[model samples]
Target: MEWLPHAQRLAREVVRPESRWYSAVATVPRHTYVPRWWEADGDVWILRDGQSNPDAWLKNVYKDTTLVTRVDTCHADTAGIEGIGIISDGTPTSSSTLPSLVVRMYRHAMIADDHQILVTTGTGYGTALACARLGSDHVTSVDVDEWLVNIAQDRLSLMGERPRVEVCDITGPLPGEYDRIVATVSVPRVPVSWLQALRRGGRFVTTLAGTGLILTADKTADGGAVGRIEWDRAGFMPTRHGADYEHPADDVWKGAMEGEGEATSTSRYPLLYPPDAWDVMSMLALTLPGIDYRHSQDGDTRTVWLLHPDGSWARARASGFLDSPAVHQSGPRRLWDELERIRHRLNREGALPVYGAQARVDPEGTLTLSRGAWSMTVN
Candidate 1:
């Protein structure tokens, strides 16, 4: 119980004032749902349990981090009973998503106190927060996994609060009309069923699959919705059909770590950490949806690769500290040049107009972005 005070302090100081809603929600004991978990180390998953080391377990459980709760829809508690050294290489199916990202998502949703909310129930921690802020009667949580629904019910009961926690696939028609719908997972596109379930003027917040962009839109009178990105970045696991994400091609990212190119001159631009934060990556993804990026760092050397479904490829490498980077690219179109174009636009325009950009969604699910006279449409 002593840890509760410390966790609350961290949530308030490190998370709350900084606008991290997930961290405040993390004050709830994540270890309750994740008494055992499997950590990913490259291609392998290692199981860690509460009984193994008390101090280490406590440290990890409350560190404002996300813990993988299930792999391929198989809960860790069941998987661990088999034995140790059992490798589960399947993709992560469910998790207590990181608190900072969760909070960022909620902030984008802009839930009002009296709004009726429908939220995805994974660990139920997010559900608890909704109930804490907006009252249990105002929140309805759903999960496709019945076990999770039951577990969340029990946990909510333990906290002396009750909301309608049910087993329903969110990809399909939801049970009730809601003023705010916040999904903790990503979706390929906004499902029409969600629009059918939303009240007029209701707002929905979600992320696009395969990218870090968050989509926030308000329901419109004509049965569609339109909203723009907030001034933030977030990513989440894609929405699942049954219980997990479809397996990605194993060889898709294979051999990317080999770093097969010559060292280049230092780039004019300073090397960015977590290259996804770069505006170029976001623009590239918007312009070309299926392109994938991989980055690796070893000592003083850094390499970035861009691969496309059409076999177009680009690689950039830098050795030591340098300003102007040598770039190597080959494909239908020069990828580095495209990045340079985006960067140039960013510099000349002083900002890439993504956040607060105008969005219009048609009833047919087409999304169009409009800024000034320039526009891009996504189907």
Candidate 2:
């Protein structure tokens, strides 16, 4: 397969020619790590096989885009020929992260040649890139799924680079200490285990679940870590303890989708998809954590729903982007009102406090995010 030129082009797009990671980006065969992947078409996931169409495979593999290799617990590599139809259920569990984002995470770590790094193994493509730059001995990769780890190790060995790949839950006790620990998966909070595994003064970089905040911190002397919410935002799938993520109960969503809540009002602002706005979503998550955001469009109308596990729900319907959404709220809390308060803050201050906020993780894994006088403690 003539894939070197494509990789070289990808390298140029993601890194400078003089950068240490440039060669790794230019040389690693990303396609080898993702022979088959799931591509989304509207609400359904369609399987794409590289062997069936080499041209499309090269196009997707070389592009600076993420490819979902596993949906729920079903890996595309093992999905066989029968898994080509539209799959509307379940969520993506594993993916080959975009090359640029992988490089961005590595850059955040300020990885030195001598620094040992622990990274997550998704498609093993990121692991391969790390091995190419820092050598297999300096890199250690871990994944929760045994099959994922086994296949990744085999691929790494085939490339003549065998790093330590283990089937371990990254949120739990790590296998060893390292100078840098970078997680491509987001977590609800900084795990105490991560702090314990990091060598003193080591750096850690990862995203927070339910938000698009990329946090970068350094281990402090007191067995804790201090850092800031980075201005650059990236979102990754939240870490799971088992084969798949535990979704909210169906009854919770039922109220949000069907019921006319206890209160109804017209929103002062237009309908905004929370996920599409990183800062807004981050502030909402910080203020009212555990709100599940959902949105759908029918013809010219757009409807947004916010469901909480505590039975609180909110729905907003708008005919146009600039039109005021008719909002409804139910349960013990006024969820839409809370969202409006956030929007009001943004309108009044021109910015949200989530980005660039100071972050501190206690030894017990509690995280506090503060900006100016505003503070939020996440346990």
Candidate 3:
């Protein structure tokens, strides 16, 4: 399609140099994998297809963005050749992750041509880039869905290159040893299986489940890999064994949103909406692990909810677009206080040390980060 040139331009200008990975962004046809797609609108996935409006699809596809290709592992192919039908209703199980994010993760991966690498293959676009840079023989790409693997294999073959495209869950035992392993998907923990499959001195890059932290570490002789956060923030769909992510606690958001009942506490810091873009949120997550945030905006009121695994939660709301907000919190830990503390550290020190921090992982899966005298341990 004529749109290919535009996609190439966006890839070259936005994703290539910024991420420093091989420019598969220009080579792989992202539109082909996403002939029809969906976007999250509130609680539902709104189906959008190329055939209906080629102009709109062209613009959306080439914007250096991610399109949800499938939901609940149901391929968009079920909607017929033109990609029209009932929009599948469920969480996004897989996608061609945004090109910028893909490149960023690859940059964090620090892959070299001589090192054999294992990478997660979904739409196979990432695998194509790996094969292009490292040679097909040096890259082993695996995915849990055989159909995805097969389609990706065909796509790669069309380009005169073929890496080992196989149907295997990335969280399990990999087929071969490699000096580098990069997972496009997030995982609950550094899958022990990955550490076991990595050769000594190998490096692995992945994201922690439900967080935007990119964990990069090198495989050790003791079988554990040690590394630190890349200092850049990234997010990916969590890894799944079969198809979809394990369901989160039902009504978890519902209960928190309703403001059923709770004791109140003064927040140690000012609350911010959409913490994903805030460096302090990342720092707070690292400093006080297991805290998650949710935000809601309805008419004049904007509310933010913080939930932790330790049964701690905080709800803050502001009216009339005021600069300050009223907050209420409960549980064993002062969640917002911790966030404010992190923000205070950032304010005083000029920046948090997460970026460019050093990491080390022992054989037992314990991960440690160090920057001067400040250190944090993650398991």
- Quote the lDDT for 139 in model 3: 88
lDDT of each: 0.73, 0.91, 0.74
Candidate 2 residue 363 Cα shift, in angstroms, is: 1.0
How large is the C-alpha RMSD of every model relative to the true structure? 4.2, 1.2, 3.2
**Over all chains combined, what TM-score does candidate 1 have?**
0.80
Q: Which has the better lDDT: candidate 1, or candidate 2?
A: 2
Clashing pairs in 2: none
Q: List model 1 lDDT by residue over 1-379, tens digit each.
A: 3567546754764464544353446456655655777788876777788667767776776666888877776777767777654464566788877665666677778887788999999888778777776789999999988888898789888887799998988878899999999998877677888888989999989877666778899989999998986667776777777756544422434533343433323346755432456456666677766666666777888777766665455666777546354565554656566666777788899877666678787776778877776688877
lDDT of 3 by residue, 213-283 (tens): 78888887778776777667777887778766554433345555656436665454455753654566666
- Per-prediction TM-score to the true structure, in the order listed: 0.80, 0.97, 0.85
Per-residue CA lDDT of model 2 for 67-158, tens digit only, reads 99999888988886554445786589999999999999999999999999999999899999999999999999999989899999998999
Question: What's the alpha carbon RMSD for model 3?
Answer: 3.2
Question: Considering summed lDDT, which 10 consecutive residues are worst modelled in model 2?
Answer: 81-90
Quick one: ranking by lDDT, best first? Answer: 2, 3, 1
Which candidate number maximizes TM-score? Answer: 2
Q: Which stretches of candidate 3 lie over 4 Å from their true place?
A: 15-23, 79-90, 158-160, 287-290
